[model samples]
Target: MGTETETAPLELDDIQAGALRGRPNPYAGAFLFLRIDDPQDGRTLVRRLAKVVHPADDVTDPLTQTSFSAAFTHAGLCALGVPEESLASFAPEFVQGMAARAGLLGDVGPNAPERWESPLGSDDVHMVLVMLAPNRPQFEQTLELARVTIDDLDGITGVYRQDVFSPADGRNSFGFNDGISQPCVEGAGIPPTNPGERPVKPGEFILGYEDETGSVAPVPQPEVLGRNGSYLVIRKLYTDVAAWRRYLRENASGTDEETLLAAKIVGRWPSGAPLALSPDEDDPELGSDPSRNNVFLYGDDDKGLKCPVGSHARRMNPRDAQVVGEIRLHRLIRRAATFGPALPEGVLEDDGADRGLMFAAINAHLGRQFEFVQAQWIGDGKFVGAPDEVDPLAGAHEDHGTFTVPRRPIRRRLRDLPTFVVNRGGHYFFVPGLSALRWIADLAD
Candidate 1:
C-alpha cells in the first residue's frame, strides 16, 4: 500500500494547479460549461487559453493574476480530434459519464441524472472553464472576457454557467466549515497542515509519476497526451439546510447535545475541530489551528466513542481505521467550494432558495481513487462494520437511514435520516498538464 521512496522533485511548472494541490480559494468564481459547435474553432480557443492558464507553482508569485483551469469531457476530446485508440485508454467510468453509471456511484431516485439539470448529461456541455478571482469585480471581468471570447468563436457555444462564492465564515449552506480535510500530495512541495497526514504519492492524484504501486500511472498514449494529466469529477450537490437543521433541533435535547450530534455526523465540530480530540464540545482554538485541527486519527475511536465510524469524514477518509483495503489507495484531493447564498444567520425555516456545493474531486487514477471511494466507502457502509448503514450526511438511503452512535449500555442510533443532499448534476473530465494543453491546442485534425 506504500509507494517507492523519494524520486526527484516534481516539475511543478509543467503541471496545472488543479492536478497538484489546487487553485487558490477565491471569494468569487464561475463555472462555464461549453460545447464545440465547430471543431476547428474549438481548437483555436484551446490554443488561446494555453497562454493564460495557471500552473501549479504560480501561487508563490506575489503578482500572480486571477486563475483559470480547463478540462474536457470525452466528447470534447473527440471533437478536438483525439483518436478513438487514445480515448480507449481512459477509464470506462469516465467514458460512460456520471449519470450513466449512477447505480455504481449509488446515485438513485431524486439524485440520479434523470432528475438533474437539463444540460448535465447532454452533448451540449463539451468542456468546462473554471475562473476564480479574489473579488467579485475581477471574477465578473474574467467571466465577461471568456464569455466574449466564446461568443466570438464561430465553433464554440456557452452552454451553461453557475456562479459560486465563499461566505464570511467559509461555511456551507448547512452552516458547517468545509474543505478542512483535503489530502496533501507528495512532491508538490506543500507542507502538510494536518500532523496526522502523510503526503500521498503524486501518482495517486497526478499522472506521469509513481503511484501507490510504485510505477508511473497508466495513461492515454502518446506519453505527451497523458503525462501530468488527471481525471476531474465535478458535481453540483444541493444541501437541504432546513431539513438538516430541523433534524438537529429535534434529535438532541439541548444546544450542547445538538452540537455534539452534528459533530458526530460530520466527525468534526462546526468550527472544524475533530471529535476524536474534543468529543463533547468544540475547541475553537484547535479548530482554527491548521496543525491541530486535522491531526486526529480514527484508530483510537474504532467503536466511535469519539467519532462515529459512519460519519461523513470517516467514510470519506478513514485514516488508520480498520478497512477492507489500504486507505491510501482511495485518497482524493477535494477542490470543492460552496455555491448559492447562506441562509440568513439563525433562520431555521425553509426559504425555498437553492443552495449547495460545486464539488471537484481531482485524482490521477480515477478508478482506484475517486470511483472506489464513492462506490465502496461513501455509498456503502459495509467497510465500517455497519452493513445496513449508509453515510448519514451524503448517502442515498433506500427507505430510512440509521446512524449508530457508540454509547455505553446501549448504542444510541439516529433513525430515519432523510436525504440531506441531492445531486443536481455532475460529469467526468480530463484536465491535461500545461504541456498537454498546448499539445491539444496544436493538434492537426
Candidate 2:
C-alpha cells in the first residue's frame, strides 16, 4: 500500500551545480535509517515513519521526497558543536532495549565487528535528511530540522552531502579540469551513455513495488540472478595530482594531461569516444559534449585499437555488449564522490594524507554486476594483453610504484606505470526510504 502525491520535481542537477560553485559543507543532515528492528516489519515501519515525515501529504513519488529535502540550515565541516542524537532524545528504556537487540549495548569496545568501512562514512547514520527539499513532502521537516539542531548543539561539523552535476565536472586542486570521463549507464541506450552495450534499467536497483504482488516481473524472471539484490562496491580512492602532473609532463613528449588523464582514468577521452578509436590522442570537446559523449564500444577489431584492452571503462563493462548469451544485462551507476581538499602547492607537501574519492555503486546482483567487473576485467590482465594490470583507475596494486607495478611478471607486471588513481577511504550502504527512517529514530534513546 505505498502511494505517492504530485509535486514539481526538484532539480538535483542544479542543486549539485550550486553546491559545487559555492563549496557546500556536509554538516546539516537529518539522516534516518531502519531501526534495527524495523526490518522485521518494513510495511508497518514504513507507514509510521511516513506518517511522521509525510503528515502534510503522501510520501508518494521521489519528487515529493526530493522537494521535502529543501529546507533549513546545517553546520559546516569545521563546526564546533555536538548535538543530541536519537540515543539522547529517545527514552532510556527503549534505547537500552533496542541497543541490546542490535548487540551494540553488549560491546563497549571502541572497535566493533558489526561496523563497515573505516574513517567517517555512511554507517555513521542511516537515511540522510537533506534540508534542500521541503514543499512536496514537509511532514518530516520538524524531525529533520531537529536533527540538524542537535548536530549544531554538539560541537561536530559536517561536510556537504556529495552530489555533482550531470557529469560531475569540477577542477581538482592542481587545477586541471577533472570529473572529465565517467562510465555511461552501460545499457541506457540513451544520451550520456555510449551506444555500445546498453546498461540495465535504473528501476532494477531500487524497490520494485510491482514485484511484491504484481503480474509479471519487470525483467521477465526475477528468480534468475538480479532480483531485488543490489551490488554494493566500495573503493577507497586516493588522488595524486603531483604524480599525475609529473606523469603528464614526462609523457607530454607525446600526450598531455588533458589527453592522458581521460585515457588512463576513463578509458576514453572526454568526448565519450573510446581510446580504441584514437589510441594516441584525445577529444576534449567530444569528451565534454553531452550529445556525442558516449558512442563507442569494444568490438573485436576496434578492441585494442581505439581503447587499450585494459582501459578502465572496457575493464568495468566490456562493450562486446554480450550478456546471458546476448541479454546485455548489467550496469554500474557510480553514486560516489571525491573527498579531501585540493593538493597544496609544494611538491613535498604530499604527505600521503587525504585527497580522493569514496566510490560507491548500486547494481542488480553482486556477481553479475560488481564482482564480475572486478575479478574478470580489472584484476585479471589476461583479459587485455597482460596478466597483472588491474584497472589503472581503481586497481589496488600497491606494488605498482611511482611509475611501475613491482614484483609482478612482465607478462603479469606493468612496465610503464599507470597511476590512474589512488585509494583513500569508503564504504557501502543500502539506501531505504522515509519509512525505514523512523525505525532509526525509534532506535535512538
Candidate 3:
C-alpha cells in the first residue's frame, strides 16, 4: 500500500493515445505489421512516424478523435539498432516474445505458435502500426497518412494487414458486449466508469510513476526510452461462431434456456448486462448504461448462484471477490476489436469465413498483468475452486473441457466444450512515448 494517497500527474502529451484511451464504438480500424529490412530505413520511417502519432492528450478533443499509434517487437528494436544494454533492459517475457511462451500461455494444440499466421511469431515482423477512427472515411485518411511514411521506404515492407470494425450491436463475435471493465488509471484524466472504483496508480500502466507497490517498476534502460511507455500484448483470435451456436442449440432445452446458459458461461448477457445484477434475465437498459453495467461485485454471489465462479467475466475481473491472487494487480486495459464478416443471425452451419477479434492488452508489467491473468486465471480455474475448468468462452478448451454453471440444488456441468476461440497469431510490443520515438529515430547507428 505504498503511496496509496499520493497522486502524481501523468505525462499525457508524452504517452501514445492508444496506450490509455479506449476506441470509440462503431469504429473502423486496421492493424498493419511491417518488417524492417534496413536499420536506416527503419529509423527514417520512425522519424516520420513521430510526427504522425498522436499523444494521449490529443484524443480528448472530439475534432481530432482518430488514433494512430506504433509499437516495436524485441526484434524490431534490435533491427532499429537499439544498443544491446538498452535492449536487455526490457522485461524477460517481452524479450523472449509471445511465441516462445506459448506453452505457458496455453497456446497449444490448434493454437500453437508453429500454426500461427506467417511472419507473426517470426523475427521478420518488426513493427506494428494501428489506426482507428469513427468511420471509414476517417480511417482511410489515417491509413493514407501512415502509407506516406512507409510507402516509399525501400527497406520497410508490409508483411500483413487486417482491417477491424465494430459490429452494429457493439458486441463481440460471440455476441457479448466487450470492453466493459477497463481499469481507471489515476491522473490519466479519465474518470472511473463505475462508482467507488478506485483509480489504479499510473505506474501500474505507465512507467516512471508510483505503482500500487509504492515503487516504480523497472523500466527499459535509459529514462528517455522507458518513461511514459507501456507494453502491449497483441493476439489475433479466430472465433468459431457456427460451432458455438451448434453447442448451445444441442445442450439447451429451448431458446430461452440457451440464452440463459450462454449468459451463465460468460457472466453477462449479449447486451453486456452482468449476471450479478441481472441474474434472472437480460436487461438492455442496464447493460447499455456504463455506470450500471460494470458496477456489481461477487461478494453476495459467493456460491455462484448468479454469475458462475468460473465464468469468463468473474475469472477476468473478480471485482472484490475472494480469489487466489490480488485482482487489482492483474488488471489489464483491453482494447479489443472485431474483424471480418459477421455470421448471419441463427446460422448453425460453418460458412468457412475468417471472422474474429484483434485483442490488444496494454499494461506496464506484462508478467504481473497480461501473462499472469492469462496463465493463472483464464487457463487454470483453480483460484475459483474449479481447477479442471477454464474460461468457457476464451479458454484454450479441448474436446474434453467442461464448464460448471452453479445453480439451484445441483449445478449443471457442460461437457465436451470445444475450443471456440483459436489463436491465429500474436506478439509482444513496446509502445514507446512520443519522446522515445524521437530518441529511437535519432539513435546512432
Cα RMSD of all models vs. native, in order, equals: 2.5, 11.7, 2.0
lDDT of 2: 0.38
lDDT, candidate 1, equals: 0.82
Candidate 1: where are CA atoms >4 Å away?
1-8, 23-26, 61-65
Worst 10 residues of 1 by lDDT: 1-10
Q: Candidate 2 lDDT, tens digit per residue, 147-215? A: 544342222223324322111244433343333233433122223545454434333333322211222
- Deviation in angstroms for 439 in model 1? 1.3
**How well is each residue in 1-445 modelled by candidate 1, as lDDT tens digits?**
1233436567778787656654444468888899997778988888877777778887563123566889999889999888788889876778888878888888789888889997987666799998877678888888887876677797887788888888878777777777777777887877787767678888887777787777776776777888778899999989988888889988989888888899899888998888888988899898878677888788777898888888998899899898899888889888777888787866778798889988888988777888888888877889989888888898877797999998888889899988888889989999888888888888887
Candidate 1 vs 3: which has more TM-score:
3
lDDT of each: 0.82, 0.38, 0.90
Ranking by lDDT: 3, 1, 2
TM-score of each: 0.95, 0.54, 0.97
Q: How close is candidate 1 to the true structure, as a TM-score?
A: 0.95
Better of 1 and 3 by lDDT: 3
